[model samples]
Target: MTQPSQGVRRSYGVKAAPYGFLLPAAALFVLFFALPIGYAVWLSFHRIEVKGLGLGKGSRSEVWAGLENYTSALTDSELAHSALRILGYGAIVVPVMLGLALFFALLLDSERVRARSFARLAIFLPYAVPGVIAALLWGFLYLPDVSPFHYLLDALGLPQPDLMDGGPLYFSMANIAVWGGTGFNMIVIYTALRSLPNEVYEAAKLDGCSQLQIALRIKIPMVAPSLVLTFFFSIIATLQVFNEPTTLRPLTNGIPTTWSPLMKVYNDAFTGGNIYAASATAVVLALATFVLSFALLRLSNRRTTQGATR
Candidate 1:
């Protein structure tokens, strides 16, 4: 047989190289993400049945639950309450966090801003901290005895309100998320701002537009994609809030084990020992996330297309 031509070998190598490079990533994705999700989905439709007073291996068996778990999760008042709490939390978090992120990004991009580098680093520093650690740190700051705000109120002879109770608890939790997240979102928006053509700003200036006017008109519109991206992540993160409230739980009675949907899933799986129910709730939350994310993206795309057409 004739040896393969150099061109044939080269073409084969070119075709094979991309797959070779992707192999590791594909394997890891399957092993870690895809397999786990598939397993959870399988577990969601199963329940463990106990027999003979649950005493031996033969006493326990896995049985098909069909949509029983889903039905239970859907009808669960605790789950519904948790869902509402998260929605309320997201209402406070997504807007306030993204607004501050946008403001800081625009401020850092402004020509008159001082200590720009230091300010950016300071804002983004909290992003470096782990979510659990950030929650713990903020939890301490909310404590009446240790909190500086409480100390200030004492000094001024005013009533010091509990930060971890009632209406204040929502803001307390929101504040932790905002503080930890705003910096990262700001960096994303700031990077997008920096990518815009300077000519746009110059043209606006030549047209007698002030800095604020240029920001409101040109800068914001230019970075709308980044804003949408940040908003999407913020909404997801707000919905999945667990660490902040969980950490604060020990400090106050306001936070329950099922304070958020994700937390409710956790409680069902571990604390309540109902893995099937937990899996079903997790699947529901995941589906809701996908639906909301797709809807938002579609809306954003429609708006973008309409804007471009005009």
Candidate 2:
């Protein structure tokens, strides 16, 4: 047998190189992300059945549940209530957090602003803190006894209402998410802003466009893609809200074990000892996230195409 020509070998190497480099990533993705998701999906349609005294080798067995688990999860009032709570929470969080992020990014990008570096770092510092730790820290500050707002109100002889109860609890939870998240989103938006061409600004300036007008008409529209990306992640994060409320639950009675849809899944899987139901709920949540994300992306793409055509 004779060896292949150098040209043939080089061509083969070129074709194989890309796949070789991608092999590790593809393997890891299958082993980690894909496998776990597939397992969860499988579990969603299965339940455990106990036979006889439930002590022998064949006593406990996995059985197909069909859509029973999905049906139960859909009709679950607690889950529905949790979903509503998260919707309200997201309503408060996504807008306020992204708005502040955009505002801060604009301010940081402004040539007129002083101390831009210091301000940017100061705003972004919270992103360095872990989500659990941030929730714990904010949980302390929300307590009436330790809260500065409560102290101020007390000192001024004003109403020092409970921040952990009723309507204020929503704001309390929203504040924790916003504080931890705004900085990261701001960095994303600011990076997008920084990537814009300086020529655009010069032209706007030549046209007598004010800073506000340039930002509103040029910067914001240009960075709309980044905004859409941030909004997509924010919605997913909001729907899967678990850490803050779970961390705060021990501190107050206002938060329940099923305070959010993710928390409800947690309760069902571990606390309630119903893995089938939990898996179904998780699958449902995943589907909802995908649907909403796709819808938002399509809407954004449509608008972007329209803007480009105009």
Candidate 3:
């Protein structure tokens, strides 16, 4: 068979170079991601067989378990409860956090706002601190004894409710998430806001639009991409909430070992001495996070396109 002409051969050879460059990345992907995922899948579907007195090398064998692990995880009421708690927590955290972020961002963008530099830096400074440390600080503050709120209430002769227990614990936890998250989300949105052309706003002002109208109509819609970005990340962060609640565990008796899905996975993997189950739960959580994020992104993107068309 005749090979391609010289020009055609050179064109093919030039086109092939990019794939040749990508070969290393492909290899690393298989080595790191694909291999580990496949191994996890294998482990998720199998259990160790303990024989005799469970003391010998042959005492343990890898055996197939079908969907027993998955079914068990799905039916697990504790996991379900943890998931529901997180859902409620996210419902509170995401909207409030994003709303505050947008508000602060708009304030920062406002020309008449005083001390914008100081306020912006002060707000964003919390993002520099670790989540564990942030939770620890807030956990103390939420304690009635250590809280200034309680002190103020005491001076006014008011009762101090138990913040480290019951429904308040959810808000306390959500507060930590909001505090740590708000600054970063604000910066994302503020950066988007800063990129807006002055001419558009000037023209809007030339028309009959008030400052509030300009902000509500032009500024918010313009920064929809950043809002989408922060929303996506907030959902991921909310679902994987572990560190804050775990840190607060020392301060409160209310938080269980399985307070969050990640905490449950940690308990199963380490405390419960069931790495396989933990891995399975982790995989399931990860899959759920991905699916939810994907669905939300699709919905957001559709709405965004429809708004743009209008």
Candidate 4:
């Protein structure tokens, strides 16, 4: 048989080029993400059965557990409490973080703002700090004996409040999240704002709109997609909160071993030596995240469609 012509070979090469470039990424995704998730799902459906004295190889065997692990995880009271705590934490972190992000983004985009680069850096600097280090730093600051706030309060003869426990603890945790997250979200919103056409702003200004009016009526609506993106990520991060609380746990008793769902998963797997249950709980949490994220996207799309129609 005659070999294919060079023109046909070139066409084939061009057609295959994109997939060739994407091959490494696709391989990495399958190897790292897909396989691990598949294994976790498999593990979630199986359990170790201990037999006789549970001392020999034959004494323990893997057996089908069906939905037993999922049921136990769902009915777990500790998990319920942890979920409630996350809801409250999300309530605080999401709005405050996104609000500050949008506010900073708007400020940075403003023409009258001075030292914009320095101001942007100052706002985003906290995000550069590692979460564990930030948590530890703030944890020490929450201590009355070592904190400057405590010293100021002492000099003023004022009562010092314990920030590491009770109601203050929520704010304590939320503050860390807000500090770390706001900057990243702000950059995203700022980039979105910068992409907006200057003609719209010029027209609005020609119509006698003030800066505040332009931002409120024009900039915000134009940047709704960025806001929604930030909101989605904030929700995901709040749901998966582990580092800050876990780091600060040594400083206070307010945070439990199962403070968040991810924390609970860690404690169950390594600490409790029950990987099966942990896998089930993790799967459940992943499902919940997917559901909530999907719902938010749907709601956002619907609103965007409505706005476009009008």
Q: Per-residue CA lDDT of candidate 2, range 1-310, in tens?
A: 3456877889999999999999999999999999999999999999999999999999999999999899999999999999999999999999999999999999999998999999999999998998899988988888988888788888999988787888999999999999999999999999999999999999999999999999999999999999999999899999989999999999999999999999999999999898889999999999998998999899989988998999
lDDT of 4 by residue, 37-76 (tens): 9999999999999999999879999999999999999999
Against the hidden true structure, what lDDT does model 2 obtain?
Answer: 0.94
TM-score, candidate number 2: 0.95
Summarize candidate 3's per-residue lDDT along 1-310 as a digit string, tens digits: 3456877889999999999999999999999999988887777887778999999888988799888788878888999999999999999999999999999999999989999989999999999999999999999988887989889999999988888888998998998989889999999999999999999999998998888999999999899999999999999999999999999999999999999999998998899987778778878998999999999999998998898799
Tens-digit lDDT string for candidate 1 (1-310): 3366877888899999999999999999999999999999999999999997999778989999999999999999999999999988899999999999999999999999999999999999999999989988888888998999889999999998888999899999999999999999999999999999999999999999999999999999999999999999998888788898888899999888899998899999999898899999999999999999999999999999998999
lDDT of 3: 0.91
Which of candidates 3 and 4 is the stronger one according to lDDT? 4
TM-score against native, each model: 0.97, 0.95, 0.89, 0.97
lDDT: the better of candidates 2 and 3: 2
Candidate 1, clashing residue pairs?
Answer: none
Clashes by residue pair, model 4 = none
For each of the candidates, the C-alpha root-mean-square deviation to the true structure, in angstroms, is 1.2, 1.7, 3.5, 1.3
How do the candidates rank by lDDT, highest first? 4, 2, 1, 3
Q: Which prediction has the highest lDDT against the true structure?
A: 4
